[model samples]
Target: MPSNVHSEEEWARLQPHITKLYSDEAKSLKEVMEAMERGYDFHATPRMYKHRLQKWGLDKKYKEKEVIHMSLLKKQREALGKRSIFFVRGKEVDWEQIEKYLHRRPDLKTKIRAGMLKMSSDSFDIVCRSPSPDPILHASNTLQYTDELLRLLDGYYVSSLSECPSGKRVNKVRDYAAAIRCFRRLDQARTMILANMLEPGFLALNKSLDDLKFVVRDQDATLIFYLCDVVTIFDQRHSPLVVELLRHTYGILQITFGESHPLVWLLRRLILLPEIDRYEVIATVVKAAVDKFERPGVDDRVIERLKCHYFLLLDHMASKGIKTTASFPEMDATSMDAVSVAYLGRFADRLVHSCKFEEAERKSDLMLPWLQNTANRQHAAWPDLQLFYLHVKAHGAFTRGDNKVGEAWLATVDQHAGRYFPNM
Candidate 1:
C-alpha cells in the first residue's frame, strides 16, 4: 500500500473509526491528522464519525489532547488519584482498578482519609476549590487555605541553617517568607514556624528577614513588628540573629513608615536593647553615612541614607520629648565633633535653600549652646576662636535685624568661619 494512495472502500471503512477515536478524546482536526499518522485505525463512516465527535464536544480546535500512553496516565493517577483514565499500549485501562492493586504509603493513605487530597476524572478537575459559598467569604477563605497549605509544607521543607548550605537555606526561608506575605497572614505564619525553629534555625530566619526587608508590603508591618518582638524575646539567648533581624525589621519599618513615623520609636527601642551595642558601633556607622553619603546620587549611599533617616528619627523623638538614652553628638564648626563644622555649614546651606529660615536658625541655635559653653569655659585655641567668631557674627546679624542673615552667619561661624578667628 502506497502512503498517499487509498481505495474508496478503504477510505470509507477507516475514516469513520479514525474520527470516532479522535472524537472520543476531543482531539482537534490537526491532532486527528497527527494521531492517524501515529497508527490510530479509522474504521467507521466519515459522516457518523464527524457527527459523534461534534456531539461529544471533541470537534473544536481547542479541545483537550488525548491521553495515549499508560505510563503518563499512571503518573497522573498517582499524583491526582484514582479517577484518571489510562490508555495502556493503545488499549484503554481503568485507573481505579489499577490503584486497587498498588500498595499506598502511609502519608498517602492519611491524605486520602483526611480528604486533603482527592481523585478526579480529569487532571483539571483535581484543582482545590473554595469551601465558602459566598463570593466575598470564598476569596478570604481561599487565602486562608493557601496560607495553611504553605505553613504545613514549610515544616517539612524548610531546612535549618545548620542542616543545609547557607545559600540554599536562605533561599528556602525567603521563599517561605514571600509565600506568607501573599496571604496577609505573615504574623500567624511566623508564629507557627517560629515555634518549630530551634536556636540554629534563627540564623536562617534572620537571613530570610534581611532578604524580605525590601519587598515587604505595608500590610506586612504587623508581621515585621511581630518578627522584631520575637527577636527581642530571644535577644539574650541569640544575640547575633536577634541583631540581624532587628536591623532588617528596622529597615522595613523605615521604608513603610518613613523616618518621622512612630514606628521609628519602636525601632529605636529595639536598637537600644541592652545586649545590643546600640550606641557604639551601629549608631556610629549610621551617623557617619548620613553625615557623609546619603545625598542625591552618591552610589554607596544606603548606609548614609539609613543613618540620616536615623538622625531625623532621633530629632523627631527629641521634639516629642521622648527621653532616649541613645544620643549622637551634635555637629559643630570648631569643636572636635563626630562630623566637621564644614558639613554643618553645608547642612545650614541646605536649610537656607529650602527657604527654611527658622529651621536654619534653630540649627544655629543647636550649635549655640556648644559654642557658648566652649567660650565660657577652658577650650582649645581652634574651638575658642570658632566660638567667639560665631558669637560676634550672630550678635552683629541680630543687631542688624536680618535674622536670616544672622542665622546663616551663626551656622557658618559655628561650622567653619570660627576656625579662622582668634579668641577675643
Candidate 2:
C-alpha cells in the first residue's frame, strides 16, 4: 500500500465515517486521522486524507478573505436594520478576527453601511432566515455579538495605551479609570436590557465582565506594575480582569527579567484564575510556558510552581465539592521558592482539615528547612508554613499519644494567633 494510494472499496466503506467526523463533529484533520485509527483501525497518510477530502468536498474552513467579506456583509445588514447571520460549513465565523478587522478599517465602515462598497464571495451565505429552534440560536447569536463588542472595546483600550504621550500616562490612566466607571454603568444598562428579554442574560453579563479584565494588559512594559497596583486598589473584587492583567504581567516580566525574578513568581501565583470547568485553560497556558522556557535550557522551577498551584486549585474546588479530573503533576521541591512553599503549605492545611494527617505531616517535613530559617520568617508565606507545621505537629503528636507535646504545639498557635491573625 503506497502512502498516496487508497482503494475504491476502502473509500466507499470509510467515506461516510470520515464525513461524519470531519463535518458534523468538527474534528481537525489530525484528530480525524487519530479517531479513524482508534475506532476503525484505518491508517492513511496526510496526503491521502487531503486528496479524499478534496474529492469529496469536505473542506470546512472559510478562507481569510471570505471571512472578511462575510463580516462586512453582516455589518452592512446590521446598519440597515436587518439581521444577517452567517455560517461557514455549519459553524460560526471567528468573530474575534472579524472584529479586529472592523476596528482596523473604520474608513470602510461608512462606505459599507451606506451601501457604496461590498465584498462578494461564494464561501458563505447571507442567511435571511433564523436557525431552527429560534430562541437557542438567538441566545447564541447574542453571546457572539457580545463577545465581538467586548473585543472591540479591548481594541479601544489598546489604542489608549498606544496613543498616550510620554510623561502623561498618569493623566491618561486617571482618565481611563474614570472612563471604566462609566463603562461599568453602561454594562449595567446592557445587562438590564438582556435580563428583560431572556433567561441567559446573566451569561452575557458575565462574558462582558470577564472580557473587560484583559484591557489593562495591553499597557507598555514599563507601566505594567504601576497600572496593576492601581487597578487592584481601584477594583477591590477578585475580578477576572485582574487575573488577566497579572497573566500579561507575568509574561512580560518572565521574558524581560527571567524566571528567577521575584515578580515573575508573584505573578505566576497570582495568575491562577480558573472558572468552573475552565481550569484546563490555566493548565494549558502553564504547560506552554514550561515548553517555551525549556526550549531555552531553563530549569523546571516553573513546573514546581505550576504543581503547587494545581494542587491548591484542586483543593479549593474540592472544598466546594466541585469534582474535576485534573491531577497534580509530579514535582521536585528541592529548590522550591517561598511562594511555592506557601502554596504547598496551604494545600497541606487542607489535607489536615480533611483528616489526612499523615500526608500533612509529610508536607510539613518537606518545608522544614524553610520553616526553621529565621530570614524565611520575614517572608510573606512564613505564617502559612508556620500554621501548617504547627497543625501537623499537633495532629501527629495526638495520634502518637503524646498529649503534652500536642498541647504545647497547640499553645504555640494560640500564643501567636493574635499576631498571625490580628483582624481575626
Candidate 3:
C-alpha cells in the first residue's frame, strides 16, 4: 500500500469535511472515511485515514462517549501488570492467578527477566480486609528468601546485557545501567541487608570485573572500567552496610598508565562519548537527524568534552582521597600520545588542589618526570602543559614553607625566560 502522507493544504481541506461527517452527523469512522473518499479527494486507505485521525487527535472528539466501564477482567489484569512482584490475594499474595496470566503472556517474562521491569516495593503489605483465611506471605527463612531474590535479580541483569543485540545495544546498555542504579538502591530498602549474599553478581562491591566485560558493547563498555576503577569514594573499611555497598560497586578509580592495570589499555580503545551522545552508537538512522554542519557540533566539541569528563572523574578520585601513585609499575602498554598526556596533566593538576601538601608534592614529582619524557618526545611545550608542571611544584614548595624554592619557580613563570621554559 502507498503512504497516506498528504500535504498540509490537503489535510487542512479534509479536516472540516471529516469533522462534519463523523461528529456532526454521528457517522462511524468507516462511514466518514467512505464519504470522504467518495466526495472529497481522499486517496488514502481507510486504515491510513484512521491512523491520521488518531495522530491528529480527531478520533477522540468523535469517539462514542460512555461511562467508566472497567470490567472485572480489566481490573484483574491491571492489578497483575501494575507491579513486577505482587501478592496473590488476601493478606498474602497468591501466585496462582498472576502465574497463570504470566504463563499465557510469555512476553512479560522477557521484559522482567531482562531487568527492564523493576520491583515496586520489594515487599508490599496486602490485606483482603474481609473474612478470608489470613494467607500472609511469609517465608520459612526471611534472609534466605531475600538472598534468593537478589540472585534472581542478578541473573536477570546479566542476561539482559547478554541478550542485547550487538552494534545496536546503546540504549540497552544505558537502560541496564539505570536498572543497576535501581538495584543499587535496593540495599537501603530494608534495614537488615545481607552484604555478602547480595554482592559480587547482584551488586558488586570491590570484586574483579572479569565476568561483565563481555556484556559491554561499544563505548558503554568503558562504564565497566569506571565501575571497577580505583575510586576512593569510600574507604574499603567503611563501617555501615550502605557505605560498604557503595565502596564495592564504585571502586577506587585512580588514573595510571601501564598494562599491569587495565585502565590505560582500556582507555586506549574506549571511545570517549559525552553524556548527550550516550545513545549515538545505536545508529544515526535510529536518532532524529542531527545537523552535521551545525556550529560546534559533535566533531567540534567531542575532544574537549572527553577532556572535561576525564578531568571530572580524576578530580573526583582525588577529592575522595583515592591515593594517586607516584609511578606506574613497568609494563608494556599503549604509549601515551599528546592528547593523552594533556588529559593526564589536567588530572594531576586536580590532585594538586584536592590533596594535601605532601600528596600534591608527590603527584608533581611523578607528573614532572612523566611530562619531561612526553615533552621530549612530542617537542611541543605549550603554556597549559608547562603551567601544569610548574604550578604543582610551586604549590608544593609554598605549602612546605620553602620561600626560596617557590620564588625560583615563580620567577621562571613571570620572566618567561627562554631557558626556563625552552619550548616557550
Candidate 4:
C-alpha cells in the first residue's frame, strides 16, 4: 500500500468521515482516531491522519483549551455570566433564586426584570432537626435537593452489573447513559471514568490532570502502585474495589495515552490481588492493556505472589470445609512461619465459627508455640499480628474455661502493649 494513500478521490471519501468525527459531541482524540480506523476503515500513519483532521477543521476539538467541556450548566454560565437562573430543560429550577423576586424596590426592579428565571425562597422552616451536623446537603451552591439536579443524578447506584431493564428502576439500565451519545462513546466514557474517577480509596483527588497532565507523565501508573500497596498493607488483596479502580484506571489511560507501559505494569500488579473477580477484572484489564502494549511485561514477583495467593485461596476454601473443585496446591500446616501461621489461624477461625469446638481449640494449641516464638523473636515487627495471636489465644482459652492460661496470655499482651503501643 502506498504511504501517500490520500489521493484526490481518497480525500473526498475521507472528508465525510472527518466531518462526522468533528460533528461528534465527543472529547478525546484517542476515541476519534479509533472511530476513524474501525468505523471508517481509514488507515494511515497517526501523523497523516491527524494532518487530514487538521485540514478538515477537526483539529480544534482535540486541543485542550478549545474542546468544549461536556457539562451543559458550565456552558450556559460561560455564555450568560452570573445572575442567570439555575435551570433545566428551559424551566426555572432555582427554588431559592426566587427569593430575589420578592422585593419591589425601584433599584432592584429594573435589574431583576433582566433575569431569565427566578423563584421564591421557602420560609417553611419546620424545625428541621438532625442528630449530627448535616454537612453535604446544607452546603450552599450545591443544590443537591433541587428537583432539576436530582433529575440528572438520581438513582446513580443502580448496580452497573444489572443487565435487564427492571420495574420501578429510577436509574438508566446503564450508568450515566445519557452522556454516551453526546460526550463520548460508552466505551470511551467507561475508560475515562475508570482511570480518573477520584474515589475515596484512590490518591488525593486534588491532583491536576488538566492538559492531559496525568496521562502525559504516566501518573496513573503511580496511583496503581500506590493502590496496590494500600490493599496489600490492609490485607485487602481480594477486595473488588482495588480491582475496579485498577481496571478503570488502566482502561481510561489506555485511550488517553496509548501503549502506556506503566499502566500495564500496575495492571499486572492488580491482577494478582486475591479478592478480585478474576474472570472479570483480571480478564478485562489484561485484554485491554495487552492490546495497547506490543510486549506486555510481567514481573516475576507478581507471578510468584499470584501463585501464593491462588493456593492460599484454595487452603481457605478447604478450611471452610467446602469441597475443593480444583486440584490446588496446599500450604504445609507444619511450618511456623508467618504465612503458615496465618493459614493455621484462619483454619482455627473457620472451625470455631462452624461450632467444631475441640478442633478449633486444637488448631489454636498448634499455633501457640509459633506465635510465642514469633512475638519473642521480633516483637517490634508486625505488632498487629502479634497482638492478634495473643488476643485470639487468650479468647480461645477463656472459652474453654482455662482462666489461668487466659490470664497469663493477657499479661504477656499488656507487657507488649506498654512497650510497643505506648499510646494505648
Candidate 5:
C-alpha cells in the first residue's frame, strides 16, 4: 500500500480520474477509492504524480483568466474617467491601451473583475431609482455606451470562435446569454430606455434569441418558453423589433424543434400582433414544416394539426378586420396553393359551426374559382362536396327558422363525420 504521508496528494492527483471513472461507468466513489488503493505505486511524490497525470491528458487545472481580464478592463475604464492624466510605467496612458492590456492578460480574475464592472451602488440607488430622472438624456447616454459595448463583445466572441472552432475555452453562448440578460435588466431599469429610439436593449434581446438558437438543443425548453414570454411583454404590438425577433424565433424553432413541438404554440402566441407582417413570419414556419415532414409516410395527424393552426391564425386575422391576401412574398405559386386549400377547408368548417350558410357559400365560390385556376390541382372528393352542401343547407334552414330541415341536415353530417368532428 502507498504510505499515508502522501495520501492527500494522491487523492488530489487521482481526483479527476476518479471523477471520470465514476461518470463513465456510474461507479461509486468508494469503489474508485478501493480501485486506486489496489493499483497504488509508491515511487513518486504527489506533485510528480499530478504532473504525470496532466502530461498524459488525464487531469485539468481550473483557470480564471476571463474574470481577471474583465476586472482589469473595468478598473482601467473607471480610472480613465476619474483621473485626467492616468500614468502607467512612467508614461501617460489612455483607456484604449488599458483595455488592450487587460484583454491580453494571461490570467483572469472572474468574480473580483465582474464586481468591479458592476454599476456603482450610488448610481443604481440614486440615478436609476430616482422617480424623476432625466429620461431622454439618461437614455441617450446609456444606450450609446451599452450598444458600443455589446457590439465589441459580439465581435470578440465571434473572433474567438473563428480562431478555434472546437476550443473548449470560455462558454461563449452562456456568456452571450448573460450579456443579453444584463441589457434586458438595464432596459427594465427605467421607462426612458423603453421609449428610446436606439432600442439597444431590444436588439440585445434579439441577439439572445440568436444565441439560444445556436444551443437550443442543449437548453431547457421551459426556460426558452419563459424567456420568450418575457420578450413578448417587452415587445409590445407596435414595436417593429417584434417582427424581426419573431422571424428569427421562427427560424430557431424550425432548426431546433419540429412544427408539432409544443414550444411552437408559445411562439404562435407571441406573434399575435395585428400590426406585424403576419404572412412573412407564418410563411417561414410553413416552409420549414413542409420541408421537415415531406417523407413518404408522414403522420396524417401532424399534418392536420398544422393545418388547423394556420386556420386559427387566419380566423384571428379576420376577427381583427385584417384582410387575408392570396399572395405571400416568400411563398411560390405551388406553396401558396397548398396553404390556400388548407385555409379554405378550415374556414368552411368554421362557417358551418357559426351557422353562416351564405358566408360559407360565398367563401366556397371564391376558393373554387382559384382552385380551378391552378395547373395541377388536387382533386376534391364527392363526399367532400356533399359535406359542404349539407353544411350550407343546414345554415339556410337555421336562418329560415326551419328546425326540421336543420335536424335532417345534421343527420346527414353525422353519417359523414370523421374522428376530428365526431361530436359535431
Candidate 6:
C-alpha cells in the first residue's frame, strides 16, 4: 500500500505488526517503516506513525524536564540507601541516560540537590505547628512532653537495635520509632499507641490482641489503640488537637525524610484522609495524585493500592450515614497486588455492612482467584482473609434467605478455621 493512501481496515490489519515493530522491538520510525515496507509491503508516513504511537500511549520519549526530575528523584532515593526504579509515560527510564543528562547539566544537578527546582508532585513542603504553645499549656510543659517522648523513643530505638538488626531494617525501625514518639506526644497520650499505620506489618489481616501488646503496657483492652483512633479520637473530627497532631506528625515525617521519599507519600495520604471531610474532595485529591503518579517517584502499584484504600474509606463514611453525592472509586482487581486484593476483601465486607449483599457477593466471588494467585497466600494472614471472605459469603447468603447456601458457606468457614486455628 502507498504511504499516503491507507484505509482504516489496512491500519487495523497492520496494528499488531506495527505494534510489535515499534513498541516491542523499540524501533525508530524509520526502522519500523523500512521493516514494514520490506517485510509486509506496508508503508506509512512518519506523521501517521507518530500520531498512532501517541494514540496508543506507546510513546517512550520524555521531555528534558522530566528526565531531570526523574534523575533528581533517583539521587534522593539512593541517598536514603534505597534503590529507585522509574517508569514514566509507561516506559522504563534508562539510568545511563539520566546520568548523562545530569553530567551535562551540572547547574540543574546543584539546584535539584539544594531543593530549588520544583519538578513533580513528589516535592512537598513541611507544615509545622504554630510556635505558640496552646493557651491552656505552658512552654515548659510542652518541652516536658517533647523531652519525655524523646526519652521513650530513645529507649525503643535502643531495644530495637539490640535485636541484631542490620542495614535498612534498623533505619526503618529508627524512623518509625521517632514518628511513633511524635504521634504520642502530639496526641497528648500518656500511654503509647501500639499500632503504627506507617509500618507495613500493620496492614496484615491476621493481627490479634497479642500482636498489639507491644504498643501499650497495660493488658487492658481500653488502653490499646491504633493511629486512626489518635487522629480522629472517636468521632471527634475537626478538633484542633487532631489537626495539630496530624500536622506535627506530617512535619516530623517530611523533615525526617525528604519530600520525594515513599514513606512521606504514604504518610501524606494517611493524614489526608482524616483532614478532608467531604468524599468529593478526597476523590478529587486521589484522582489528581493518581494522574500525576507516573513521575511522583512512587510505584504505580502502590498508588493504585492507595486508591483502593481511599474507596474503602469513602465506603466506610457512607455506611456510617454520612451523606455523599460522590461515587466511590472503582478498581481493576485483575492486575492488582496483594495489598489491593486484601483490600478488596475488606471492601466486600463494607458492601455487606452497607446492606448491598448482592454486590458484596459479587466482589467476594471475584476475590477468590485473586487471593489464590497472589504471593501473599503463603503468609499467615491468608487463612484469616479466607475465613473473612467465607463469612462474608455466608452472611450474604443468609441475608438473601438462602439458609442452605449460607450453611454451606459457614461449613467451609468452619473447615478453614479448624485447619488454620486448631487451638481457637
lDDT of 4 by residue, 256-335 (tens): 54653444443434444334232223223322322322223533323322333333344333432433343322444444
In model 4, what is the error at residue 284, expressed in angstroms? 12
In the range 1-424, model 2's lDDT, one tens digit per residue, is 4244568898878987887677546689999999988898788988888888877765445443464577666654432323445666566655564554444345554555455665764635434332232112233344444344334333433444436676433222121222122223223323233224222333333443343344334342223223223223212222333344455556656666567644455345334323321233333333333333333332345444444444545444453344556554543466555644554555555465566777877776777776777777776556645655665576556656779998998888666656784542
Each model's lDDT comes to: 0.39, 0.49, 0.38, 0.39, 0.41, 0.50
lDDT, model 2, position 20: 63
Backbone N/Cα/C clashes per model: 9, 1, 13, 8, 7, 1
Per-model TM-score versus the true fold: 0.19, 0.32, 0.24, 0.28, 0.23, 0.36
- Candidate 5, residues 1-424, lDDT tens digits: the string is 5454555566567655554454334454455555666665434444654454444433111112322333444444322221123333343344454343334332322434445444333311111110221112233344343334334333432443335444332222221223223222322221223434233343344444545554444432123322333334333333444444554566677667676444454454435534333333333334343344444554443344344443444443454344554321121323333334434544554465456767666654544543455452333333333344455455556555889988998787667656323432
Residue 372 of model 3 has an lDDT of 61
Model 1: which ten-residue window has the lowest total lDDT? 125-134
Candidate 3 wrong stretches, greater than 4 Å: 1-311, 317-334, 373-378, 381-383, 417-424
Global lDDT of model 4: 0.39
Which candidate number has the best TM-score? Answer: 6
Q: Per-residue CA lDDT of candidate 6, range 1-424, in tens?
A: 3647788788878876786576546688899999989998887788988887676555335444676567666555433323556666555566676665555446766787676876576533312122342324333444444344334333433443325334422222111122222222222121111222212222121133233233332111111113233343312332444444445445644565457543344334444443333233333434443343334444455445445544555454453344444444466757654444455666676576567987887788776776676575675456656666776787677767889998999899779879986764
- The window of 10 residues in a row where model 4 has the poorest summed lDDT is 175-184
- TM-score of model 4 relative to the true fold? 0.28
Off by over 4 Å in 6: 1-226, 229-295, 319-330, 374-377
Shift of residue 50 alpha carbon in model 6, Å:
90
Error of 3 at 106 (Å): 75
Task: Give each prediction's root-mean-square deviation over alpha carbons.
Answer: 24.8, 26.9, 20.7, 24.3, 20.8, 23.4
lDDT order, best first, reads 6, 2, 5, 1, 4, 3
In terms of lDDT, model 2 sits at 0.49
